[model samples]
Target: MPTGLLILLYLVAALLPLGLAWAQGLTPRPLVDELASGAGILALTVILAEFLLLGRYRFVARRLGTDIVMRMHQLLARGAAILALVHPFLYTTRRAPAPDWDSHRQFFVTADFSALWPGIIAWLLLPALVLMAIGRSTLGFRYETWRMLHGLGAALIAGFAVLHALRAGRYSADPAMSIVWLALLGIALFALAYVYVLTPLVQLRRPWRVSAVTPVALKTWEVSLRPARNFPFRYHAGQFAWLNIGTNPFGLWENPFSISSAPSAGPELRFLIKELGDFTDTIGQIKPGCRAYLDGPHGHLSVTGHSAPGIALIAGGVGIAPMLATLRELHARNDPRPTALIYGNRTEEQIACRAELESIASEHGTRLTHVLSAPPKDWHGATGMVSPDLLRAHFSDPEHKRWLYVLCGPAPMLEAVEDALIELGIPSRNILSERFSYD
Candidate 1:
């Protein structure tokens, strides 16, 4: 689905309960009490929507991009936590049960433990979940482990929160509101099950086995996977997949990696992985013929359908993975358009597949520029960074602004390069980029 439509759906879902409650036409309450209810319900709805933005749903990720989806998940989660924590204090209604004559709960609010316990549990859980997510990188937990726990924690909070709403909320007293909340909760839980159970079960039939694991550069390796059978996986250039090696289809050790090989190169998939800890640090230990599973062909960064006059690919470090795929595909398809690859690394040793990149340049007429931050004293190529001045020197012509530019690199380089590209009179649509790191 398109991004705007998805957002519209979210707005409708979030406000449905409030609309239904207003339709109930119950007695009026204090403005602060109504505001408290609105905040609580909105927070719950946002939490439910977070499940759909789980960063694995292709319908959302393909349109919004995984980086945007993940960023949205984190940001909205913090917002929801704040709302959940403060809604209770915003209430001005009396802390007492509904009177014998007041069946609509207009003037009274339940302070009973039976109705408040679930809300209390959810209130405490939300902040902890947000904190864990914020500090996850520093917590020394495996990505897979943290992801599994995060899902479980969110599910727990959703269940408790909705239960409390149905039991205690003045607006949720309406049957329509109850149904909406329950249905939304069901959808959220099913999303979790789909990622954990259904997707893995489907992958069981189309499994792969590692064919090779060779060191490509400093602390980086090229791992190859060939289908055990005639697996028919098709992905565009500059896309990625979740790779689980030597683990069951249901295992949590899977991690996303950009496809380094072109799709035209048969059933084998290639990935250029740099050691950054976690599963990557153990890449060397993964031998050939180990069972593997892939859950993707995700990401929206591609140049397949563009009719640009030329293409410029800027890559830093392992961000070259998808660019390699794009270069190989363009070469295989015998594209006539001119192409340039600007690859940057700390040293010459950090450059991966130099021979192949050069061979592409020689055979396919690609212009290859290598930039080194820590160059050797005798370095003949471009020294220093792939800076704005270098970009200006190469793309000095007015026609270069119309060329399609694809950039993948560290966040800082990407931002600097993007700003420079826009400054060079390139339209925003003419430049394509996805940050390897969202934060």
Candidate 2:
């Protein structure tokens, strides 16, 4: 779906509870109490919808990009936490319910312990959940363990929040409002089921085997995979997949890596991975014929549908993985459009597939620039970072403004390059970028 339409749908979903409550036509409570109720309702609905963002639903990720999806998940979770944390304190209602008021429009808060405990549990856990996510790396937990904890923790919060909503909320007393909360809860549960159960079951039938693991650059390896049988997986050139090497499809040992080979390069898949600790350190140990599984083909960092007159690719370190896929795809298609690549690395030894890149550039008339931060004596190539000055020198041409710019790299480089492109009059929509890390 188009991003604007998807955003519209999200807005509709978020506000649906408030709309339903308004339709109840109950006597208006004090402004403070009504604001508290609004906050709680929005918090509940948004928390439930947050699960769908990470459910591996291609529909959401394909349009918004996985990086965008993850950022949304984080921001929305924090917002929900703030609202939930302040929900109880905002209410001006009396401790005991107003005896004469209708059950669905009580002017006083309920003091019943059973009805309040679920919200209390959710309220207490929400902050911890957000804090754990924010401090995931600092806590020094394994990626797999942290991922498992985050999923279960969010589910626990959702369950208790829903329970509190149905049992204690004034708007939820109506059958119509109760049905809405139940449906949202069902959707949240289904998102979890789809990711953990149904997706893995399907992946079991079409497995992969490691074909090659060759050192491509300093601290980086190019891992290749071939289907165990005749597998039929198709993805865009600049997309990525979560690889579960020698692990079950349902396990949490998977890590996402961009497909470094072109889709046009037959069925074999390649990933250019740099050892950055964790599971990546084991890349050199995996022998050929090791069992593997994939759970992706995600992200929206491709030039497939653009109509730009030229293409510009900016990559740093292993970020070149996806750009290489795109470059190879363009070569396979025998495209005649002008292309330029700005690849940056700390040392010359860290440049991946140098020969292949040169061959492509020579044959396809691509302009390839290699920037090194630490060049050896007598080095001739550009010696510096992929800075804004360097970008302006290469891409300041009038015609280049209409080009489609693709970026993949560490967060800092991506930010700098993207800002430079936009500052140089390139339309923001013409720039496509995918981050290599998510927390």
Candidate 3:
């Protein structure tokens, strides 16, 4: 829908200028006019979609509809580059009393380097951005580093494009065009400054404190935090937050961890993290009194409005954090919604919050089932992976497909479960799954 609206707007902008020129008898060559207008529109559309809309660096991007937003920006940026190279040529060729070949060569290749410098910088920025984005993981660039470079690149490209358009004087000759350009640029600039500058600075002022850290598994730990003041923003179950560590208010080193403790379960927030890289390994060493900053309460995998006769939750590994929070939230609400949870781990040791989960389930009239893939000898709980057969054997109405199925687990397990549900003729909307890409 957004793509289609963008294309329609592009066509409108492209044709309006050409229509005015034609009516005023400015150009006799129809083909040249059409080509110039089309290229100009394509360039503007790309500018609007890429740097202006989706690429305005924000903390929410990491948790929001990030994948789709990023893909849109990449596609539009490439398209803009192609249009930037074509528009000037078409416009110059169609001008009245066309200049000599040498005159054309001078303007295209040599004249007014000051006016052209910004465009040159934009061209360089494009490929650099593409390289960084594509090679982000392969090049070992951390999220914060990529984010900083990404912001700088976007700002340069946008600033250059705005200057280039005004200097060329072709698109901004009219009042309407000038106003539109300014409005678009203003919006983009505001969003960029707000997200990259203002928000982080505000967070830096009211820093949180790390109160406790306990090892949950070989590579996983539970972190406890308290705000400098009592937080008014109440969080729902299964929501996550972006934790900014070190002196990095620049958004270069932030990680999203689901709140393992329910808001009702405690005054402080708890995050269950697995040591995947440089950040998590040193997280446990963070002093209890050290100030921290958090931006959170995101994700919508909660138990709100999900009132079926029965509920089923499936978690794998650290994914159990959100499910545990959900159960706690339900317990707090005094929701007598009969709920069953199936938690999976590689071994019994990897299962986080086992006792806590069992206690919560028992206290709240819920059922907790543990599923281990590689349990040691003398293990008694449901062994092997949480497969379709396992679910069928354990639950009375596994195939009924009427109960609410909220799944938080590894992608592979979620994929398998989704496939299993489809195989059992369940509607796609009936199943809700959360796939965390924290790694």
Model 1 clash pairs are: none
Q: Please give the TM-score that candidate 2 achieves against the real structure.
A: 0.96
Please give, for residues 332-363, the per-residue lDDT of candidate 1 as tens digits. Answer: 99999999999999999999999999999999
For model 1, the stretches where C-alpha displacement exceeds 4 angstroms are none
TM-score of each: 0.96, 0.96, 0.77
Best of the two (1, 3) by TM-score: 1
lDDT per residue, candidate 3, 184-296, as tens digits?
A: 67767776777667768877766777889888876789988887776564787877777875565665677778888878866688889988776777877877876777766
Residue 179 of model 1: what lDDT?
92
How does each model score on lDDT? 0.91, 0.90, 0.69
How would the candidate models be sorted by lDDT, starting from the highest?
A: 1, 2, 3
TM match of model 1 to true structure: 0.96
Q: In candidate 2, residue 253 scores what lDDT?
A: 87
lDDT of 2 by residue, 1-439 (tens): 7989999999999999999999989889899999999999999999999988893789988888888898898889999999988889998888785476456556678877888999999999899989988887899888999888888988898899989988889998888989989899899988988887898898899899999999999989999999999979899899999889988899998888999999999999999989988899999999999999998888888898888999999999999999999999999999889999999999999999999999999999999999999999978999888999999999898998999999999898889899998999999999999774555
How far in Å is the alpha carbon of 100 misplaced in model 3? 12
Root mean square deviation (Cα) for candidate 3 = 5.4
lDDT, candidate 2, at 107: 62
Which residue pairs of candidate 3 clash? 144-252
